[model samples]
Target chain A: MTDVDPIALAVFLFFFLLVTVLGFLAAKWRRGDTLDSLDEWGLGGRGFGTFIAWFLIGGDIYTAYTFIAVPALLYAGSVVGFFAVPYTIVLYPIIFIFLPRLWSVSHRHGYVTPADFIRGRFDSRPLALAVAVTGILATMPYIALQLVGIQVVLEVMGIGGAEDASWFVKDIPLFLAFAILAAYTYASGLRAPALIAFVKDTLIYLVIIVAVFYLPTQLGGWDSIFAAASDSFDAFNTENADAIAAGEVSGKGAIPPGAAHWAYASLALGSALALFMYPHSLTGVLATKNRSVIRRNAALLPAYSFLLGLLALLGFAAIAAGITVDNPQQAVPALFESQFPGWFAGIAFAAIAIGALVPAAIMSIAAANLWTRNVYKAFLKPDATPAQEAKQSKLMSLLVKFGALFFVLGLPLELAINLQLLGGVWILQTFPAIVFGLYTRWFHRHALFAGWAVGMIYGTWTAYNVPAVGDPDSHFGSPVATVPFLDIDIYIALTAFVFNVLVALAGTLLLNAMNVDGGGDLTSPDDYKADAGDVGVKDLPLDEMAPGEVAKGTP
Target chain B: MPDSTRGSRNTRPVWLLVALLLAVAIAVPLLVPLYDRATPTFLGFPFFYWFQFMLIPIASVLTYTAFKLSQAATRHDRAARGQKPPAGERGGVS
Candidate 1:
């Protein structure tokens, strides 16, 4: 790496080291009675108030990749990139509708993971296992995308690699970053991200506020910015006219036409449905102190969505400023580096890096919680103690981070993005089992499992067959596909989800009609209403009820 | 598990109104073609961009209103059941 700016690099490292120290010390910041329980390590003792939960969940949802990639997509594609805006706007209401119930039931049962709730709701170990496994699978690529975000920043800073640098040399900075992250996450579970999120989010907000207000002035005004962006897109369309005419690449414009409307809508809707189902998102929700915290935050968290809208405008600003990068993912960072002073650029870079760290820590913790509770404790050793579970979760968190590190370092970045796209498709399959299961037990566990299998297989196959423009022979290239009997292209995830629900409904009916024994429900309907400070329920013993007996007559 | 408080007061209206608000918040943006245009601009933002940004606060206020209504319903339920409302429920937006 040549001509690296020492001032910017030093400033970036200063904030990085500061957050690393805070991450390690956070283990003791809110020390619980004991660190031996999954409750303490995995969910921050299940005691985060509304304020902390707001920052933590906000930090988790709006990641470095989002800060970078959303604007990048806007810079590259135009209107379709704005799908993120509507999706995030709609997400809170969806979360408002269902998440409190999840928090209540999970709190009542002392559930550490979504799978635990599934197991309790459906009385099926396999269905819970499916939820847990899908969570991990979907999360790994997402974590890798975070690393890709970090890599973009590092590459922009000229610290990571050169054209012919060896892989080890190229990835040394990434490995170092991951090493520090894994160390703190191992020492302090969800607490690290919970604490670090404060710093990360503050930096993000400051950077965006400054960038949104300041950057536009530097490159004329908003009108010129939009005009420049429009010009660049027009130029790109002209350059790629053949591909556009052949329907290989999407047409470029600030607004999409009638034909592309379904693709945009389905993407926004499908992503909104899938966002909260991510294990890390739920982990943040479940960690809150009460049902009101969930409700209040659902109301309050749209502040980030507003901030995200401002951030997305930076894409047009980047085009107006004439910023260019080999990878469009680097557009935002490259814009900051080009426009801002050295120290401010350093702060912006630190914001992006810490952005990666917060979500990475939370995601690994969530994935670790899933693996420990569902796979290790459920299938491997049913009698594992809370202490044992805590220890296993700590270790598994490291493995999960390293696995994401390997994914970014070992594979092409395009593949990482593709895998995360597939992840979005895959995670939506669990909605029928988890989100639907929250409201009803009418869905047979075996049928839900079968539905999950069908959705997973069908979604993967359809995604694999869709060819990417310009990158011939690549599979899983786009999330949109034509409906089976109709000539319309829509999000494959929503289509597969429909198939999942229909199959699940049919199977539930047939199974019930055949007198198949639907497994016993472990949670009472009242458990869905229990909130923090509720008497008796919070202290319910893990095995207070027998395997199939619901808690009856409890008031 | 049948509690007297939940059954004593009617909360269906509050919940139905909240559901209606949320439905509108979610539906307006998903019907993409309606706002996918450039003519109507706010501070140089095209309709596609500004329309979604405007929905953020509208969604938030609707959610907050729903939260307050639900809280009010809970308080009403407690009073109807001849029980003292929890200390935390005594004051706030309501």
Candidate 2:
């Protein structure tokens, strides 16, 4: 809120440089034979153990966006924001059942991206391309949103985002931070984030642990915190009863009302189902050493979920502490600056900024792998060698980061957010092809493709038509929409998914009866059950079998 | 092939239990209407707030046990396929 605190600035810079050095140094840590293969660079040799994989995956899922937006929802009196807690609670149980299957198949076939799996499983180029393109498209706004996370923290620190300042000055600090991130990621690939995650998680846990335990006592206790939030919501509803009745204003509460119970549950469930489908989340899963690593982490990772719930409650604490901010995203940051001492606030700022950096690094690398393996290797240069493929991924990671930069700086922030809003629903459309295909090839390849297309078109169109509350003319206002036949509202993505399944089932039956070629299943049933030590399951040399080959590439 | 297929089917109940645990873990949280209330505050936190926080640990334990039970089934499946207990089981994951 004020000009940069000099002591805080020094503390933030010290940790920033510390991690900057760690990012470059990671290329040599647990040295791979060469850092020129996708396995080495894009996936950190596909060699992370349980401990490192936990931090890496944690970094990807529990992002800076969660810190900013989750609390902001409560601060802004949006009850559904609390859905994040249940979303994460449900997420691990779901992934435990499936991610190991993905890791096994990915390692078995050297399938570097989900699209690689799609192409190999379904043997359809167009379908693989759809999955690949959606991964990249959905990923870009996400990386941009990470930049927005850093931008928010920097603005809170008085570093950039001065409206009066020239454009360069307004963006220069963020530009510099991203430049450092881009260079390290290009140098070290997945290793950069994996190594730095240690530092990022340490800072994050320290700040959150201290903030949760310390902040509550400063403003009485959790009892008063919840009471204050409830009272505040009640007060607002009383004042805005007329506007609420007129449908111009939303009534606020600590818990979702009965009418919104479906909305609350659907958003949580839909997001949980959609999350691992994102390329970045899958990248972390595939990067681990073996199947057990994933399952154990599923059990362990909920520790973060517990802390995340407390972090969400910080919104209520901010209310009780009598802090106010115009942009709700700044509420937690503002609360930190007001309550904590100078150096500690600096550490908190660094935590959020580094939180942004780790995920951004991982996302760009994942999207880059998708482009190199699925788009470049699969189509542009089918016989490209491992070295050439890695070269392409290295260069593509840089370009993907630049595209994200453009999203943050070039276009309006709303465009990136709206696209990200669509990104969630858009990415879910690929779920049937990737997830359903893992368990059963019962869904026909072309049928799944048609399902994907229908889902994507329907989700985008429905989301586009959902006007904002009070601003009936605006588009993409809410992610929830009224179900077609039901009076209740739920996430549009889930509804689209229902339609997608019906179409896929119908399409499969019709296609089969007409004797359409269903494409060969390159993977055997045992492939899903393959583990690290199994034959044909390590990182396959590219010439032996580059992923997405229609014919059997297995020697 | 029939023997191996039957081998997997013979162990179906343990796999079924894992499935049941996971199903409960996933479905119980989505039944939000059951806990959507302000009555019966626990240590000053509302029933709604404290109850959801409590589900975190319950769900974690359920998943943990599911992982343990499934590991045994996975080992049996691997043995049926004439594979070792997955270098993962020989020692913990590297």
Candidate 3:
């Protein structure tokens, strides 16, 4: 590694400070008369129309993960990393089909988290609790993953953990970043992220466009880079493809056919399904003014996906440039520094660092909403006012930030990576019950519960058995490790989804045969199409049902 | 249900058409990979690598079609409710 450059680091740090100031000032920029309700704090008063929702959801979905990890995966795994490109492309149609209906229903009912909808949909406290806990659990690691992105950028810029430095000196960046993130998020709530998304997306686009054109020329050409990568792949296949085919790694260059193709498709589908389920993605959708905004954004957001395809190719550019990042995740940042002038490299670093801020803000806000609507009111304070709920959410947002900081600082990178894999397995189990529930309520409430249980069991068991090269301890290897028989990567989530469908169908049959009556729909068919109607308490009173009133079944 | 309609034929066809186009939009990606070989080159990148890039433009065309179709449906729905189209009919659908 080269000696640290203080000047470039200072410029990057200054840009981050500018963003923090902007974040704090956003409270006044979008100020409402009162910021005491969850609507104001969590969803930005639901005032965002098409323009802001486009940038907000774009910034949220195309994360530092897009800028950093996807390319790192490409550098490490060849064709497999390209899956992110297609997964994002396919995600639009999947979301377009169902997400607008979800937005219409949630906005009509004044719901904040998906869990709140579940509580009203199933009229079952236990199931809503499951959704809430899963959301919180799934979101924490993702928030931490953003910190990992920031960590890589800092390390490349010579600002993070030193080799011989004391623990405090080494870990100060993680603590300091979380401190700033938590403070602004607590102060401005969702408005902080929504406003900053404008800056984040502009910088990211600028950096990626420059890198795609600039680096290819410096590295001889796109032709040279591709030729080098292809030659490298060919040599590896000639020498070790047989060994790789026989389940042995004779050389480090070639990817086995099964390993390459399965990893590509698994990561693609797994990420697509998991993408919308994240609290941050939901926060972006919920903040929009109407259902059409959500649909139109989904239709247009592939512009960012095209950017991702460019970013992934930078991996091959890094290979051609002969750049070596100490951590593979720093591949993109290091590519910028080696190929560009110091000032532009500083700008690129700022893009990644600020990219972390938008998603981090949205994630903490979504988690806080979960705590407010589900745990705090459901158990702690059933009579809580809007003002009190907002207060609790602001505080809880800070706690979630610190909780994620601990994951980034305390654990090894490998273990932290495993937690994300575990998060995926657990999160994907929510799809059948949550995403599918948007379309049809045919799956009975009890049957939904049974489906969840079956899926969770199968997903976890298969994930626990996946093994990686030289590390059996790394169970459920990220999108690449597959279980036997199916010989597919342990997107245990998809496997779980299949199991969920089977059990749900069978359970429905058995319940009907036993003369068990399905609970009535909590929402009329027309409610799914309503955006504003009979708006009452934000938290629908759980105990207000008169006898024989239809208990909220899956609606 | 539509036999008693008074004016021109029902406009529900526009919505059904949009929904069918959405299904087709979704189906194209499912079909592309079946024929894509790993090593074949498209636009200097492998077929597997570049097919998704190609799909983006195709999807945008489909989205524009849906936008137009939904606009017509919304106008029909509004007319059925005995409401005039707003001063700005620029925004086709809700």
Candidate 4:
């Protein structure tokens, strides 16, 4: 009934400015002695401890995507939206098993990206190129999705004065926010994100905990609140009974009923597998000081998962508050403004804005690592120095930020969302090589190539055939699509993954049994369990020398 | 299979621990679906939601446990091999 308060807008801008200042200053907080190598620029000197790793990786993994989209999906769909929660839960155990091995291998080989490991492990440059290309491609849209989250929060706060502003004007807030991100990342590298993570996560917790308890009390008790939501869901379902029965839309205008369970499970699995494969997640893992830091962080990170559970519940709270907006993505932010005072709304907005920044910085840095190691050094300048590489990576990080900004502004909102879904499908193709390669060195290079190709093709086609709701003009161009026969909305990437694995197995056995050359192994079995003695860790204690090392290498 | 052989004595505990940890992690999600409805609520949220949420912390404890056990087991294996145990990479120290 009333316009969003200008005072609320001003306070929101003030908090956002504070976060940006913090983001810039972060460049100095963990300033490495030199920013020459990818280790310094790309990984913040690989010096993060367990608590910092938890927050950095947590801030990376739990982003504005989790804040805006997951709840948006719940507000729009229903039960299907809960996939994010389970996916994260499934992710920890999976990482618990695989990540230590990844750390050991990465540490052993001095590898920067998963592609680097792939290249070293199989001695295949072409495959490493594919992994690098895929990492960059998948990361760009994901960074854009973070902008979408910021856009939703900014729009909810009515930051821009225009009531019916042009599309560009509506997104100016996002552009300015990302510009700040680009600058800090270019100057500080991964440390910007790692340092800002402390603030971002703390703010997110404050906002969500307050909103979860405050909104319910303001509207009604939790029971009455949920009852109202259930009523709304029931009423909507009754009207759209045929659609509900047909599995098109659930009564809640949120998750449809027919394919909810399947969609939930598929999203959970697809997201879990895809999570670590992302360059940002890998960057976080690599930035840790040692295998134990990673292990300790893995144990401690469930606390963030606890925070995620609280964040997801904001959707039901929004529903209970009868919150509605032109864009469904604004459901949670809008709910906060509607229920809370001007000061608190400003704080909630800060959380979302800062939340977007942390991931964007990490993602940009990770993408830059791909460019420097996989693209630039691989092709442009093989003889490049660490300083030159760092300089080149800094420039490339800015370019990646702008690329994401364009995607956020130029594409339609739905298209941006779809592109990310497509990105998931695309990144999942790397799982077999990245995660599976850590434990067993058995998968042949030819078999992996066959698997990767099959997955990419099938996932793309399955996604292509999926038409948008009630859009005849749209066909292959859509990003997120329903499966051909199953008719469920999922990251088409997993479908491709399943097919790729099958083909790889088939291709490997068929080729191997026929005495086809499976190719050479770059690493032997002993390499898997090799310690610093093999890698030549200097300054070891004198008493514990291995068979071949100098006296200083003794433990 | 010799009772006195070093290979047989050393590798057993590492395998046993890996299997146990894997079983617990894999079992909770698979088994919880069976008794999810039977479990009662903690607060307003259901047992299903709580159990899934609980997995995060539980999994963390399991990982730290697994890591410690793996180190100990690896040391035993190295001792049997008549080599000094490898230095556990101190990952958390910046």
Number of the top lDDT candidate: 2
TM-score of chain B of each: 0.71, 0.84, 0.70, 0.66
Interface RMSD of 3: 3.8
Model 3: number of clashes? 1
* Model 3 chain A lowest lDDT segment of ten: A546-555
Among all windows of ten consecutive residues in candidate 1 chain A, which has the lowest summed lDDT?
A: A546-555
Score residue A178 of candidate 1 by CA lDDT: 72
Q: lDDT of each model, Cα atoms only?
A: 0.73, 0.76, 0.64, 0.64
* TM value for model 1: 0.89
User: Could you tell me which residue pairs clash in candidate 4?
Assistant: A76-A254, A77-A254, A77-A255, A78-A255, A237-A251, A250-A256, A290-B91, A425-A493, A541-A554, A541-A555
Q: For candidate 3, what is the DockQ?
A: 0.31
Instruction: Give per-residue lDDT, candidate 4, residue A247.
Output: 54
- lDDT measured at residue A168 in model 4 versus the true structure, 0 to 100: 70
lDDT of 3: 0.64
lDDT (tens digit, per residue) of candidate 2 on B1-94: 1222445445678889999999999998889898999889997788888888988999999999998888878777777767888657776532
Per-residue lDDT over B24-85 for candidate 3, one digit per residue giving the tens place of the 0 to 100 score:
66666545345346467654566555666788878767876776666556555645755444
User: Each candidate's fnat, in order?
Assistant: 0.72, 0.64, 0.22, 0.39
**1 against 4, candidate with superior lDDT:** 1
DockQ (C-alpha based) per candidate is 0.59, 0.69, 0.31, 0.35
The local lDDT score (0 to 100) that residue B79 gets in candidate 3 is: 57
Model 2 per-residue lDDT at A276: 79
> What lDDT tens digits, residue by residue, belong to model 3 across residues A109-216?
766567777777767677677777777777776778777777777778877567688888777667766765676566655555545556766777678778887778
Spell out the clash pairs found in candidate 2: none
